[model samples]
Target: MEYTVVENSGYDREKDVFSHTSYWEAFSYRARHYTDSEIREMHVEIAIDLPDGTRTYEI
Candidate 1:
């Protein structure tokens, strides 16, 4: 599976930024920049690619 870390730090949906290729890498990036509370408030998520389809969940 592949993973992507999305930063939803703005109001413009089209301008959301994302990065990373693995869950651990993505989690590390988020951990460095945001506290657990901030992450929940910002709606940060990790998008995962599976054989079935892409899925997302709060980080």
Candidate 2:
């Protein structure tokens, strides 16, 4: 999914500067139709300027 910077959040100096970034989100759904044990994995990534350097991981 693409997310445009609504505004500059100064909390993150670097990332806040840039007004846009690329992001990816992945997930698994419909386990009943597929495999429950397989589980669903999601990958979300975005590119932008931020104090933290535009990198985050959430599982």
Give the alpha-carbon lDDT of every model.
0.63, 0.28
Look at candidate 2 and tell me the lDDT of residue 40: 27
lDDT (tens digit, per residue) of candidate 1 on 1-59: 66666656333562234555678887787788778997778766666656587554533
Which ranges in model 1 have alpha carbons more than 4 Å from their true place? Answer: 9-16, 49-55
Clashes of each: 0, 11
What tens digits encode model 2's per-residue C-alpha lDDT throughout 1-59? 22323122233342322223343211121222234342222111223334555533321
Instruction: Provide the lDDT at 53 for model 2.
Output: 50
Error of 2 at 27 (Å): 1.9
For candidate 2, what is the TM-score? 0.15
Question: All candidates' TM-scores?
Answer: 0.58, 0.15
